[model samples]
Target: MPTPKAPVRGRFAPTPSGRLHLGNASTALLAWLQIRSAGGTMLLRMEDLDRARCKPAYSASLIEDMHWLGLDWDEGPDVGGEYGPYVQSERGAFYREAILRLQRDGWLYSCYCSRAELLLMANAPHGLEQEGNPRRCGCLYLSPEEQETRAEEKTPSLHFAMPDREIFFADGVAGARSFPSAGDFAVQRADGIIGYQLAVVVDDIAMGVTDVFRGWDLLDSTPRQLALFDALGAEPPRYAHGPLWLGEDGKRLSKRHGSVALSELREQGVASERIVGLIAWATGLIPEPEPCKPQDLIGQWTPGRIAQEAIVLPGNWMDRLR
Candidate 1:
């Protein structure tokens, strides 16, 4: 008999900026299925660093949606595991320590450029406008005196000085991936909140996440994240970015695009199994759409079996539910 492999540690980190939408639900379902199918541990982490937008109600709703869909997590904010405080807002001390380490190791630099300034500079002729260019602002190579002067005028965000080289990694779904460059990205914002790139890398490391399943919209961010994992001396997790869910008009799914939020669907008497079934069919895990729970599709789930291209919903998809 062959020796069994150790169970993979996977996570589904969602931001509580809004109610769970169809896109969010599909991603959550896929992540849950991947972890559960492999007999791996699944964790839920709330990416609620943006306190100004995140709310307890939103988090509650998200948890409710997951439960309704039968996506049970082994560790999460509701259930304290070895890794307690699964919420990002509660993990500030960890982020602070990591930031200090990066600074001590000379991986972090002070960035004084505002969003507007960076946008204008990026659009300027002969400016550092190319994709993944670190010299996005004059402050990238500023002297101590110059940094001090800028600091006096505006609070500086911390940026990771990205190495100018090709980064390579293989995705479970997207296959071999390579990025020619990784632009210097922010680690901490001027408003004092840690940036998503840094926070996610730190959280994944601390939580022992071995695999990550997310939408392909975040594929380009892999290289920068890999650099952070390297600088922090933590092994990066394997990534599988699936196709995004698009509206019938072939545009990204959003409220404006008629994408139904889970809450609204629940109010409309839509069963959770119906939602999961629709997602499963859309992702190529099922021959056709039929009311089914997430568990029912696990036996049929294979990461590579998922479509690499975006799945466009029917114009009257919501009408069918009604």
Candidate 2:
């Protein structure tokens, strides 16, 4: 008998910093369709690591919005799973442990440069070099004594020592992608909070997520995450970066783009089906806008059907909905 294939597992992780905008909702809808279509398990993880901005109320509202759109998760903060702590803030110890392992394996170094100094260095003539070029930073060569001395003046952030080589991966939607191995990035901030790159990799690995579907904006960060996966001896998940929803100004959708938030639309009495239908139409999964539920789109959902270019919303897009 043939060996049984493992079930696919996917996740929809969002930061609870603000209300869910059209961009966020569309991503969530696609992610839900992908997992549900494959008979895979879906998980919801709240990226509430940034205590300063992430509000509990925002997370609660996000859960409500997901439900209103008929998107359901097999596991999430609201519904506990084997990965008990789905929230990033509650999983700090895991990140701390990963950082310690990286340090022991000689894959990490202490960065003592203050924000002002780093910004100044970046703006210097030498900093104009291409991103793939090796970044010149004296902090990487600091002696133990010098590091100790700098530690007294300012808390040192942890930086991953990036390998100088090219990293490549085949994205489900965007096709093959390549990134130069250059900049040594931080895994921990000066404030001691764990960084997004490190935290996301650690959580995904622990949660056994086999696939990640997110916005195209994060496509550049894939190589960095892949490098971390290698250092941690974990297989990276397959990624699908869907095109972003842009406003009339040709910029990524944001609050500045007008009342695009789902909450605001809900308050305006816009039906949830209309929101789901708009997303389906915008993503090229459907030809025209018509009221539909999340489940109604599953049969037609395919990664290739998604547009490679960002969808530009019309200046009067809101008027059509109204």
* Top candidate (TM-score): 2
lDDT of 2 at 30: 94
Per-model C-alpha RMSD: 3.8, 3.2
Residue-wise lDDT of candidate 1 within 209-254, one digit each (tens)? Answer: 8989999899999999999999999889999998898888889888
| C-alpha-based local distance difference test score of model 1 | 0.87
Question: Any runs in candidate 1 off by more than 4 Å, and if so which?
Answer: 1-6, 123-135, 319-322
Off by over 4 Å in 2: 1-6, 120-133
What Cα-based lDDT does every candidate model obtain? Answer: 0.87, 0.89
Worst 10 residues of 1 by lDDT: 1-10
- TM-scores vs. true structure, each candidate: 0.93, 0.93
lDDT of 2 at 87: 93
lDDT of 2 by residue, 1-322 (tens): 1211347889999999999999999999999998999999999999998999999999999999999888999889999987758999999889999999999999988899987877776666644354544554688889999999999998988899888898999999999888865567889998899999999999988888898999989998899999999999988899999889999999988888998999999999999999999989889899898889999998999889898899899988986575
lDDT of 2: 0.89
